[model samples]
Target: MRQYQAVEETGMSINKKIRHIENTIVLSPSFKQAIAMIRECHERSKLTTEPKCMLLIGNTGYGKTTIANHYVGQYARVVSKDGTTVPVFYSMIPSNATIKGLACRLLEDLGDPLYDRGTTINMTSRLCRLIKECKVELIILDEFQHLIDRDSDRVLRSTADWLKDVLNRTKVPIVLMGMPNANSILTVNPQLMRRFANICELKAFNWNPVKERDDFLRFLIMIEKATFFPQPSILHSNEIALRIFCATKGVVSYIKKLISKAAEIAYVKNLDRVTTEALALAYNDELALSNTMSNPFLVDHENLNIPSLEQSFHNSSDAARHGGKRRVAEILRR
Candidate 1:
């Protein structure tokens, strides 16, 4: 019997199967390493001395925030005689964030309802007291890149300095996660850079080189195993692997999105397996890449202009923003 049939025989509902497919976390090697590092930092924070900080840098949709959330979830809050003890606190740095704004956000995350009304000094003091009281071992600042202000050097520098002060006061480890450009925030601030000397980068998969290709293929197999359909998908096939890579550019988020959408399409159409045609439809629906000539899954491999196709994929958002005018221009020129 097919995998989906077996699952259905065991009384698994279609919605449950689809939920499993959507929630699957295929932990790559880098994800495992990052989790380990987070644990190490948490352990180090128990010591009386100041804990070393970590900066996690990655491109958008590269799983930085997901990994952070995963690690923090592992150390969820515990109740003690004093109050609720949150081992790890997670907060997102708001866009155009200032020192006071960040302090208020952190306070709010720690359960201070009136955090928004306090002065910077009052908020900082209250935050430090709450951290100690709640026994927060680690602080994870997601979208740390937002702390940087391109227009105001003073605000940027002050924000970094404020972070340094928070670390000094709390004596807890902090993990800063954001896109690659966030690294510039550290480079410009010597003190902050020195404090967060340890950095971990989560990078997208690459197609070139034999090992990377093999790893990518293995990842495809993992995805296939995780997905449930009436019949097995040929995602592990060599041709499909190339097509998937071309469509997603080896980004894990994009790969998951493509597979999930394809599975949904198969279910809706009463298709037995996820086919190249289904993938093309998913790409069109999810990513808005409708040009059959540019779609790797729809075209002959030898005729595929990979560089041009990648450029088009990158520009897909811009094309949508401008109402596909640029996309039409490119197609007509071609």
Candidate 2:
């Protein structure tokens, strides 16, 4: 009975920590800039006769979708012809996205019927009419990387051209979200590429020695508070924190998982605080998991040290010129 109680307590404590860490999520500086740029473009697009499009390119787990979600919630708005306002429609391109599937998804978001006979053209026309009717300021398409994943490249190209025509007709800002290869897909379609003038690229987490230490401490504080079972205590080990930065390579997604996994292991072992021994076991487990699955995004560093800001921000000079707009152009040009 006592053993069971201990296990129960540990489980409860671990769950709390996980929840706390999730709730106290932090956006890196680059991500914050991207969100701000998107918000600004959405606002400007609503005021202008021409649509202002933005293409968000980033790596997986780098908060590309999260930033888009935030902008959709905060900035995206539908303006009525008579000046009434409401939230704009948001949709994501599916894993097995086809021209038909993407059209259906957009129509569904606009509360239109998803019946048969709506070819990519029909659906695009319908969507443009809806956008005009609803005065949708922005059409945010997440997972736009799926554009290249259509059954055939021809279908994908057709979808791209159709999307460009819709935008040309509706004059509504379009935000495309995807990972690295998304640029290649967009560039292949000249019309689509023209609409996507503003490119916001996001890199994985860059550990700012100046800011990371504080961020690391704050993260540990949240972890401590979250670990309720076995009595919460602070992590006094700097070495553990260093290992964390190394394991995650400062990428927020991987970092979140590693920390959460460490807490989980500590809970299972009935440890109050995450000890180095427990951490080592967690590392081995994570490494094993990574071998079986492509999970972690750590970089090659001596003893797993985080990369310097210089390495992370190699494109800083280029990014500063257009304040990020040119960054997308750079990618498209490449």
Candidate 3:
């Protein structure tokens, strides 16, 4: 029997299966490691005089947010007659965020009634008080890269200093996460960097058989187990696997997108199973790369120009530099 299989043979309504696909999280090894590291920092902060901070850097679409959310869920808050105890607090750093703006956001998440009405110092004080009052052991701030100057990519010194003060006050483990460029935020702030000196980098999944293929296959199987697929184990087959790898370039979010869309197509059309054509339609509809020779599902593997795995990461700057649809297209054409 397949692992974690739900009902047998289309037990769910077509819509439910499609919905389940979006919820399915395949916990690959790297994902588990990153979560473990974050948990350790959370636990460590409990005993330290100084707060422990960690920086998690990964490419876009690599599931950093998912990890943050999963970590929060794992250590969910408890409520009782004594009071509500929030073990973990998660918030996203807004684009062009000010220290006051950021503090208000955190305060809002912590249930402060007047989230937007305080001065910068007042809000930070209230935010820190709430963090301690609620007994929050960990604070997770996502989108850390937005802390840098977009033009120069330099860390915003004033905001960085403000964040350092919050950690000093709260004395709770804090996880800062963003795309790989977020490292630029740290490089410019030595003090802040030292505070979060222990860093974890999550790289994209590689397709080379010698290094990462087995893990990728296992990931697909795990996704299979999480849902009642019309057919099973078809994703890990060599042919479909190759198509998936080429289509998604081993990015977790893209893989999920392809699978979810293909499953949606299969169910809507009453297909016996997810087929290359379904994946082709899914890829075209969702990825916006259809009709071009680059669509992995539409072309012969031999004919498709798969870019170097290292070049697979998509970013705005890279896209602008390379021009057109994206760098992947440029890489494929070479």
Between candidates 1 and 2, the TM-score winner: 1
Tell me, what's the RMSD of every candidate?
7.4, 9.6, 6.8
lDDT of 3 by residue, 109-152 (tens): 88888999968988888988888889998899999888887777
Kindly give the stretch of ten consecutive residues in candidate 1 with the minimal lDDT sum: 325-334
Model 2, runs deviating above 4 Å: 1-17, 75-86, 115-119, 150-155, 207-238, 268-270, 291-334
Clashes of each: 0, 2, 0
Taking all chains together, the TM-score of candidate 3 against the true structure is 0.86
- Pairs with steric clashes in candidate 1: none
Candidate 3 lDDT trough over 10 residues, lowest sum: 1-10
True-structure lDDT of candidate 2: 0.64
Supply the global lDDT for candidate 1.
Answer: 0.78
lDDT by candidate, in order shown: 0.78, 0.64, 0.78
Task: List the candidates' TM-scores in order.
Answer: 0.85, 0.71, 0.86
Report the alpha-carbon TM-score of model 1 versus the true structure.
Answer: 0.85
Model 1 agreement with the true structure over 133-176: per-residue lDDT tens digits: 88888899999888777566333778888889989988889999
The reply for model 3, stretches above 4 Å from the true place, is 1-9, 290-293, 309-334
